[model samples]
Target chain A: QQQVRQSPQSLTVWEGETTILNCSYEDSTFDYFPWYRQFPGKSPALLIAISLVSNKKEDGRFTIFFNKREKKLSLHITDSQPGDSATYFCAASVIMGYKLTFGTGTSLLVDP
Target chain B: EAGVTQSPRYAVLQEGQAVSFWCDPISGHDTLYWYQQPRDQGPQLLVYFRDEAVIDNSQLPSDRFSAVRPKGTNSTLKIQSAKQGDTATYLCASSSLGGLNYAEQFFGPGTRLTVL
Candidate 1:
C-alpha cells in the first residue's frame, strides 16, 4: 500500500503562472512533511518542509497549505519559471522516525 | 563541504547475477540512508544506519539484499542473485541537521541498475 499519494502525474504551465501540486497521506502519525525537487540526471534536493504544529509554511515563491484533519497538503509555486520544471515529491515521517515515506512524484513543466 | 558520493554510476546485469553499489556520506553527517527509485516514481527507503550500527532495515529485502557501514563512514549495498524487479536507481543520502527524523537529507547522484 502507498502511504503517500500525489495527484496530477504530469503538469504543464506557462511561465509566471501559479501551479499547485496535491498530496495526501494515510498515516496520521506522520508529523513531518517535506517536499523534494529532482532535476533530470540529478539527485533529489530538499525544497521545503512543514511540521504538524503549523498550518501553512512559505519560502520565497513556494507555499505549502496543510490540513491536519484531512491529512492533505498542497504545494503552490507562484510566478513559475522555466527553471522550476522538475519532478516534485511529497514525503512524510513521524516525529523521531528513522525514515521517510515518499509519494509518487509530480512532473512539472513550465513553458518559457 | 563535499556532497554524498556514489560510485559505478551505471551497471547492467542479467537475472541471477550479483552487483554491489558503494556510497560515501558527507563528512560529519551521522546518519545515512539508502533508497530505490524506479523510473517516473519517487524514491523508496531501503535501509538506514547511524554511526556503524543499522538503525532500521525493515524495508530491505533481507534474503537477497544486505548493507554495511562498518566504519561509520562508507557503506556498501549488495544484491544477491538479482531479479528484473530489482532494477532501479539506488540513492544514498546523509543528514545531521534534523536529529532523528533528519528534516533535510542530502542525496547522491545515484547508481542506476539494469537487470535483464
Candidate 2:
C-alpha cells in the first residue's frame, strides 16, 4: 500500500503566480512532514518541513499548510519563478524515525 | 563543509552480474542511509545505519542486496546478482545524531544503475 500520495503528477504555472501542490498520507503515526525539491540529473534537496504541532510553516515564498484531521497537506509557492521549476516530493515519518515514506512527486514548471 | 559524495556516478551490468556502490557522508554525521529510486518514482529506503549499527533494513531485498557502514562514515551497498528489475538510481544520505535539525538529511548525487 502507498502510505503517501501526491496529486496532479505534473503542473505548470505562470511566473508571479501561486502554485499549489497537494499531498495525503494514510499513516496517522506520521508527525514529521518534509518536502524535497529535485532538479533533473540532481539529488533531492530539502525545501521545507513541518511538525504535527504546527498547522503551517512558511519559508520565504514557500509555505506548507497542514491538516492533521484530514491527513492532508499542501505546499504553496508564491511568486513562482521559472527557477522554481523542479520535481517536488512530499514525505512523512514518525518522530525520530530514520526512514521516510515519500510520495511519488509532483513535477512543477513555472513559465516566465 | 563538503556534502555527501558517491562514486561511479553511473553503472551498467548484465543479468547475474554483481555491482557495488559507495558513499561518503559529511564529517561528524553519524547516520547514513541508502535509498533506491526507480525512474519517475520517489526514493525508497533500502537500509540505514547509525554509527555502524544497522537500524532498519526491512525494505531491503536480502536475497541480493547488502549494505554496510563499517566506519560509521562511509557506506557500501552491494548487489550479488543484477536483474532488469533492479535498474534504478541509488542515493546516499546522511544526518547528524543530535541537534535541532537532526531530521534534515543531505543527499549525494546518486549512482544510476542499469541492469540488462
Candidate 3:
C-alpha cells in the first residue's frame, strides 16, 4: 500500500503565477512532513518541511500548508520561475526513525 | 563542509552479475541511509545506520542485498547477483545524529544502476 500519495502527476504553470502541489497520506503516525525537489539525473534536495504541530510553514516564496486532521498537505510556490521546474516529492515520517514514506512525485513545468 | 559523496555515478551490469555501490558521508555526520528509487517512483529505504550500528533494514532484500557502514563514516551496498528488476538509482543521505531536532538530510548525486 502506498503510504503517501501526491496528486497531479505533472503540472504546468506560468511564470509569476502560483503553483500548488498536493499530497495525502494514509498513516496517522506520520508527524513530520517534508517536500523535496529533484532535477534530471540528480538527487532529491530538501525544499521545505513541517511538523504536525504547525499548520503552515513558509520560507520565502515557498509555503507548505498542512492539514493534519485530513492527513493532507500542499506545497505552494509563489511567483513561479523556470528555476522551479522540477520533480517534487512529498514525504512523511515518524518521529522515531529516519525512514521516510514518499509520494509518487509531481513534475512541475514553469514556463517563462 | 562537503556534502555526501558517492562513487561510480553510473553502472551497467548484465543479469546474474554482482555490483557494489559506495558512499562517504559528510564529516561528523553519524547517521547514514541507503535508498532505492526506481523509474518514476519515490525513493524507498533499503537500509540505515547510526554510527556503525544498523538502525533499520527491514525493507532490504536480504536474499541478494546487503549494506554496512564501518567506522561510522563510509558505507557499502552490495548485490550478490544483479537482476533486470534490480535496475534503479541508489541514493545516500546523511544527517547529524546528535540530539538536535530532525536535521535536514543531505543527499549525494546517487548511483544509477542498469541491469540487463
Candidate 4:
C-alpha cells in the first residue's frame, strides 16, 4: 500500500531548463506536504514545503504548486543547474509532517 | 552548530545477528526521528520522539526493532535477529519544537546496514 506516489522514476534536463516533478497522495487528511532532495551518499535535505491552506509556495528558484482538490502537487525548479542533480522525494503528513509518508522518489539528472 | 550526528556509517551483518545504531541530535532540538530507507526508495518513518516521550512507533516492527531516546538528546535503534529484508539505510533526524525550522528536520549521514 503505497500512500504516496511519484511519477517518472528518473528524469533528465538540460541546465537552465525548468524541471518539473509530480507527486500524489492517497490520504485526503494529509495537511502538510514537503519536498526533500538527496545527493549521492548524503542525507535527505528539506527543500520546500506547503500546507493545505496554501496552493503554492516558493523559495527562490524552487516552487511547489499543490492542489488539495486533486490531491496532487508538483515541484518546479526554474533555471535548473547541474549541481541540482539529485533524488527528489515528496512526502505527506497530517500533523506538521512528523510521521511522513514518502513517495518512491524522482532521480533528476541535470545535464550541463 | 553541528548538525545531527550518527556513528558507524556502515554495517554488515548476517541473518539473526543483532546490531545497534546511535545518533546524537542537534543541540537544543527536542524532537527526534528515525527512518528506514531501502535502495531506490524513499525513507519511511520507523519511530519518532519528543523529549524522551514516544510520540509514534506504529510503523516500527515491535518484535525485531526497538528505539529508545531515554535522555531525549541522544537515541539508539536496535535490531535483533536481523533479516535480509532489513537491509537498508537507517537515518536519524532532529528538529526544534517550533519556529521556521519546525518541520525542517536536520538529517544525519545515516547508517547503511546490509543484512546477509
**Tens-digit lDDT string for candidate 4 (A1-112):** 9999998899999999999999999988888898999999999999999998899999999999998888999999999999999999999888776778889999999999
Docking class of 4: medium
Candidate DockQ values, in order, are 0.69, 0.72, 0.70, 0.72
> Candidate 3 lDDT, tens digit per residue, A11-95?
9999999999999999889888889999988899999999988999999999999988888999999999999999999998896
Q: In order, what lDDT does every prediction score?
A: 0.93, 0.93, 0.92, 0.93
lDDT of 1 by residue, B1-116 (tens): 89999998999999999999999999998889999999889999999998999988999999999999999999999999999999999999998864443447899999999999
- In the range B10-109, model 3's lDDT, one tens digit per residue, is 9999999999999999999888999999999889989989899999999999999999987899999999899999999999999884786666778999
lDDT of 2 at B16: 98
lDDT of 2 at A85: 98
- 10 residues in a row with least lDDT, candidate 4 chain B: B95-104
lDDT of candidate model 2 versus the reference? 0.93
- TM-score comparison, 3 vs 4, better candidate: 3
- In the predicted model 1, the residue pairs found to clash are none
User: What's the distance in Å from true for residue B3, model 3?
Assistant: 0.8
Candidate 2 per-residue lDDT, tens place, B33-80, comes to: 999999999999998898999999999999999999887889999999
Model 3 DockQ vs. reference: 0.70
